[model samples]
Target: MLGRPVSLIEADDASNVDTAIKAATKLVKDDRVDFLMGTFNGDVAIAVSEFAKQENRLFMVTGAHIMDLTGSRCNSHTFVFMPNARMMAQAVVPHIVKAYGNKWFMITADTVDGKAALQAMTEALKAQGGDVVGSVTTAFGATDFTAPLMEAKNAKPGAVILNLYGWDLVHALKAYTKLELAKEKIGVGGMIGGEQIGRPLGYANNAGVWGLIWDPKINTEGSKRFIQGVIDKYNHTPTSRCYHGYAAMMQVLEAVRRAGTTDTAAVIKALEGHEFDGLKEGRSYFRAWDHQHVQDVLVGEAYGKELGLGHYKILATVPGDAVAGGVEQNQCRL
Candidate 1:
């Protein structure tokens, strides 16, 4: 993680926890590597967190939205780069309730990611002036959602916030369409709409649906530059996930640079209450109580039709708040 460029290793499978454990064991024992990155999956992130603790190595988790990473299982060696379930919940729930209140159902993945997302969203809704009709959680890699779709159709939520990623979200939408759930419900929630769900599914489907996306189209000069860089490098604009990785990489590298050493202790010290400049949405910091980064969340409705680079039609910004809700924040002395 220091003195040289960070190296990445895949977790082997998105569905299998054992594969991630094996990879982690190898990385810590055989490869003799320092801090690890990449959250191929939420379960993988959890597995890798424990591995990092046992091996006494630093771990920077990417693409995981589970609250438990920093929650009950939080360890000093683990540094979460991706937004936690609570942060994501904080980001979307307020806006969703304000815009479309009283009816919400969770199309959750049976996996850790889906369950956690559903829990977070439910809590957020209750926190706001909203009610959760009910939610249905399905197992990971479920192909047929007919049963759940039937339940959803009966429940008839105003919004179905799908807490899934990768090909899973795509499949869920397809199932929703096949079952005509999209036709019945207002749209999905807790996700930034119109970016991914729009392209493969078509703009027509995304219409009226909203997702909790971080609008990269902000007026900030730095945001423009960051978006341009992604487009220039990848030939396609960045989405929320891309932005998360980019910002996290930059933040981690900066923390290491500021600490002037890869020593975990020093880096941790420098990172606590640290502010990041020259980045889009300027002047964000990592809280000392919880490691969540202080930044803004984007709220947008689907509209654009372009592939990869299309922008959200209308966007509202929500300022970042504390991500200290995980078990680490509880201070339980067991």
Candidate 2:
């Protein structure tokens, strides 16, 4: 997109904040990378954002949804590509309220990301006159969900919101199905859910309506092409992580083109408030106040193959502005 030779450098933070900071700082100090991207979860992302601020280098966040990234922890050098926790809650909770009732049970991973997402969802649900009936916190990698599911079953929430991800989400959903929570009229949802969960479990097993950043089948020319391209290259549907990488690359390349240089200040200036097409969403921009990208989100319901729907079907298209809340909603002062 920049129409020029671009260099790439990569590192593994091993999911540790201190390791991430050390590794990122080395890249910036050695002048080996023009910009940095990533840290899978929120705690490491916050540390990496601090590193970008101290070093005065660009850090484009790829996958980390903690509200603080673009909220209180936001910095001029850090721009976020993916939606934050609040955005995820806004994208899915209202629908959950309308369809599944206001009473909810929360199963959260005990991490900053998990807690932040749960808080966001709680606030959104409360705004709709909904409330949490029960809650459970789990260690991030724990596979057994029997205890939590049993607690949720006893609580008899109208819905179960899993503020869990990766293998945690996978295991919980499988257990939820095994226990037949749906038979008790207990619906399932999550702050974040994706093909990662749906693809493996199949729609019948994966019962819920949830928020998603992007879906290959979303009705957009750019999204269709992006999905097809990934299929051709990877021989599988792209994950939300892949979408984040593609979106971040597009934004950074566009910023470089507009700035005409790799200077951090110039690129940052170019990106702030700049709007463009090509995102899976119709159009998106970097909000100048918080450096969070504003874009639409998908609300999808898991549907079985028997229903003639692929893994999940889009239920609503929540506009970015509708879900973005406002500057007042953000804790970022700059």
All candidates: TM-score: 0.84, 0.94
lDDT of each: 0.66, 0.85
Regions more than 4 Å wrong, model 1: 1-15, 178-185, 191-197, 207-213, 278-283, 304-309, 322-334
Taking all chains together, the TM-score of candidate 1 against the true structure is 0.84
Question: Model 1, range 112-136, lDDT digits (tens) per residue?
Answer: 7777877877887778777777677
| Leading candidate by lDDT | 2
What digit string (tens of lDDT, one per residue) describes model 2 on residues 7-100? 7788899778988988997898885678898777899998898888888789999888888988888898999988888888988998888778
Give the TM-score comparing model 2 with the true structure, all chains together.
0.94
